[model samples]
Target: MQGNFWPDHIRRLIEQIGMEHPIIQAPMAGGPSTAELVASVSNSGALGFLGVGYLTPEQIDLEIRKVKELTNRPFGVNLFVPEISEAAKPSDKVLNCLQEFSNELGIDPPQMPGPPKYSFEDQLSVIIDHKVPVFSFTFGIPDKALIRDLIERDVFVIGTATCVEEGVLLEEAGCSAIVAQGSEAGGHRGTFGSTEGTPMIGGLALVPQLVDKVEIPVIASGGIMDGRGIAASVALGASTVQMGTAFLCCEEAGVPGPWLDSLLSSKDISTVLTRAFSGKYARGIKNRFIDEMSLLEDEIPNYPLQNSLTRSLRNASKDKGDSDFMSLWAGQGAAMSRKLTAQELVDALVSETYQVLKSIGTNL
Candidate 1:
């Protein structure tokens, strides 16, 4: 708890990323990851991240400046790697299915969306231009030349992987670290290697496998909420832990009131993985929307397309303070969430990790 409790390599990794603790706040892109939350966590000695995957280049620039103003400590920015091809247009059935939900919410039905306002290259240019300290991405790996560019700029690049195969691919692409995201993770599944269904590996089983395969440091993620989880991750050969659900209810997170209420009342069995909200699969608390969409699982369109279609309905639901229609993305550990300040949560996690390690007679 006091001096260098982590292994030498982990200590070096921590220092290299300018973090005092081996915790990295997961980048919850849509809304939960606020500037205040990111800064508060970084200020608490843990690395915080801004989920800028949905932001425009200009918006990303502004967000980086805001976090810098709040805290000088190092933090990270996460982007979503663009899919190789455009999503096929949805059929009438899929459109009608979404229309029913819009009618129920008394909002206008969604229309097909145009191309993304900005490209990944546009976003990456902004990140590089600002010289962000840590750059992490999900969904898939970036080009080798781009990865080289980031490393040359001294940006610590991190990539997310749901299985060992993906982790090995990331390492081969020159990632500085890899986040071994498990099936228990909340947001979009980062399973890109598979040609079939999404990978369903749990953190306990996935972390060590990825560590053994990849030479780069593996950061354990998924269902990791407390100090016990952190201790377990370290024991599994992880260099650090990336937690999202644990910080969703933090005061500084600025999550919508309805979503906050849902998390506070959730139980272990409340969450389900579905592509109801977005075409891509993600985990969130079960709701009428998800339940209804499950019946038409096969009819749903792929990501970005479905995501664009539902944007208005989601925004309307948020404005009306209705959780029933919200995405409500959360991990399996949502039941263990705590309503605390970011700093308080980080402090408690560090203290708890120290005690857990000490109690188990692990050498410091």
Candidate 2:
């Protein structure tokens, strides 16, 4: 029953975005989401997302230019909502541990990174100036004025939510879509409101609930690996699905050779929610860094600070082919994943979804 309705709405939104499929390639902010990868995904009839959270406004312009060069299709840009946090300095003991870990990885003494590459205002301006087709935000909701400005410019706005209240807030704030990010998602937890009270809800539970509540279209994310997953989301009343981990193994991803190899080879990779990598709780493959830093959970500095502090070590680990020290982000569905081109993955997902629905109809 839920599957039959909302066609006109999703269809209009899809027409507005110029996407052939309702599938969205999750905007992985780190290294994996490259301009080439995003372009390829967009060219494949799906919405490609560029994670510009770490890039400067200049870099964002360059990447956008690159994607534009590669594909004439519409793609989306994701930004981290700017927040002001006070003195999130790490404790001496944790600092010593980080230093030792850096030494072990043969990394240079971590230079305290300058503040995040771009401010929200600067980045937002870049998007507006470029006349970006779609804009999405995480970490927290943007002010109503920003949303209004984007909407007034005819740019589709999407907000990520980890709970029902956040979804309601996004709808109220005028988002064209709400991405219900489940706990099984990799990279970062997009819990907007209270981080301390964030619910680690599973995708199936979270998607349907958000769908039931929101007036706008709800997108599902987290732990979705293949065709069956997409079908499941559609059945759960999601207008679309956003997948990050599934695309991690795609040929176009900018994942390090060793990290890609680790993702491909692992038959059963377990993920843990640790703030060790970025100071914000995110799910990633369990590794030595996470294990050794377990005792520092309470003291791990907040994001941007902790994220900047570990950049050198993460880069060094990638260079040295040490997966143990790398922030190997993967969702819970990593076990049943495959390596393919972006187009091939999307085609397979579409086919698999059809087959799953056919079988269900026959059985029922």
Candidate 3:
């Protein structure tokens, strides 16, 4: 599409966010997300977000250094806000069950571990120290102190929200923009508070509704794989778009071979959302591991506990190139994804979007 197809607000938002293209590469924690991928996307005129959810402050700094070394293009970093509760802890029963799975996979299960804890404060400190151009987060909001600090550093903060209420909260907390993550998104849902039945909002419905609800620019995410999807999002009033699955198929995404192969093979019906991998709900291709976890859901521990317990098995599975135990995080748009370099993907998306817009103009 002609650049003017985008409104002044969208153009201003894109320029303010430091992206030549309105695409923002969604951060995929655990693996997949790498400095190479982030740098490539950013260099290709799109914004790349490095996933720092599971990394410590020091690690975050290291990755930021690596991204800077690879390219001087502005990129974003994503953090996971910590949420704690009694029920989220591991119970003896759950531990024993996890051990059983560990034995089956021939890997040692984790011993009794401490409660879930991560230095969100320290991570924020690193973000401030690095002075990244853009910051994005999911799971929940940070305190006012953290928010103020990020702003003081002149960091453009973006927060992910699954529902409109959460979007409003992000804006109230002084976010530069909001990522309207639909249920069709891969990886963990950014549902704040009680993880109720998040209205399974697809991009078509979610983007426009969220745009109408919030004045801040909305970056549409979930099940978006091509220029048609991007054009659709802009038509719905989104200033930009964020994508994870599309990048998963990129050369720079460091996922194991099985993961990429699965993405290539998956169809529309091959995916499901399960709390199997991490206790927290996420969407992925239905695999034997998830199927087994569904059968033993009641016995599984919460989040980090279960996540820790299965770490060895998951690692072993990846090493062996087995798809069964791999956490194949992918969205409904997986079927449309193509294996390409990150730069190529961004260029193709821009070209395709321009074509669609031109077609529409011709019709008019």
- Which candidate number maximizes lDDT? 1
Instruction: In angstroms, give how far residue 122 of model 2 lies from its true place.
Output: 0.5
Pairwise TM-score winner, candidates 1 and 3: 1
Of candidate 3, the 10-residue stretch with the lowest lDDT total is 193-202
Those runs of model 2 whose alpha carbons end farther than 4 Å from true positions after fitting are: 1-9, 267-269, 362-364
**Clash count, predicted structure 1:** 0
**Overall lDDT per candidate, in order of appearance:** 0.92, 0.86, 0.85
What's model 3's TM-score?
0.94
Model 1 local distance difference test score: 0.92
lDDT of 1 at 238: 96
Regions of candidate 1 where Cα sits further than 4 Å from its true position: none
lDDT of candidate 3 over 116-158, digit per residue (tens): 4558888877877887889889989998677877887789889
Give the per-residue lDDT digits (tens) of candidate 2, residues 1-364. Answer: 1223335656666677888777899999877889888999999888999999988899989988999999999999999997678866678877898899888877676666665555799988998998889899999998999899899999999999999888999999999999999998988998868545767999999999998898888999999988789878888888889999999989899988777776776655578899998888898888889998888888888887888888888888888877877899988888776889998988888777767877888332
Candidate 1 lDDT by residue in tens digits, 182-246 = 99998889888875678999999999999889899999999999999999999999999999999
lDDT of 3 at 223: 93
Candidate 3 lDDT at 237 equals 90
